[model samples]
Target: MVLVDAAFIIELLLKYSFPVLRDENDRIFNKPLMLQDVWSHLQLLENQLSFFILEDLFVPEKIPVSSYGEDAEKLSIISLSLELFTSLMHIEGIEENLKTITSTFC
Candidate 1:
């Protein structure tokens, strides 16, 4: 169940970045507030997954290369996450913030 939950969150992050990859019928994407709602639920401490588990699931090798010879793998999971949440959270200095945040976890 933990793996499934983690996969769901990873899928949310991926689809958040690439809207084209999202299922048109997905209820979460169909309702704007629903995504935020889910995000809120995920923020609860008990609902959280370990960062290592998320990283293992979203490893670079698991991502497929795109036509431009680039993949979402180029960005760390932290960056991909910030790409979605930073806007919702109204964060500033994303690049610098990412660096500082990533360093702490390292």
Candidate 2:
């Protein structure tokens, strides 16, 4: 299955749910979107999400890199935990953020 991002999901919701605009010739006009159409359309949104989570929430400054040093095994465990937390938070934000994005796009 395709791994759809929030903005992609929003655009699909828009194109599927909203009415298409007509041209001067009274012909149904709609832009064709390819597989990456969603990504293209939602690049800004995706970037915003990435910035919020990576830069804002999981700030590198907050992660004590120096504290986990010396012991390779302990450092690995700490690094793994941080990665897991980041992934979990990202997944959790997907649904709520997608809903917000859908409403905004619509």
The top-ranked prediction according to lDDT is 1
lDDT of 1 at 10: 82
Report every candidate's CA lDDT.
Answer: 0.77, 0.36
Off by over 4 Å in 1: 65-74, 99-106
Give the number of the best model, judged by TM-score: 1
Worst 10 residues of 2 by lDDT: 71-80
1-106 per-residue lDDT for model 1 (tens digits): 9999989988888777767677779889898699889988989999999988988877655554333255544346787788888877888776787688778987
Per-residue lDDT of model 2, residues 1-106, tens digit only = 1223433333333333223412344222244434244344444543434423322223333333424445222222223333333443354444455457546755
Backbone clash pairs in model 2 (N, Cα, C under 3 Å; residues 3+ apart or in different chains), count:
0
The local distance difference test score of model 2 is 0.36
Indicate the TM-score of model 1: 0.80
Q: How accurate locally is residue 85 in candidate 1, as Cα lDDT from 0 to 100?
A: 81
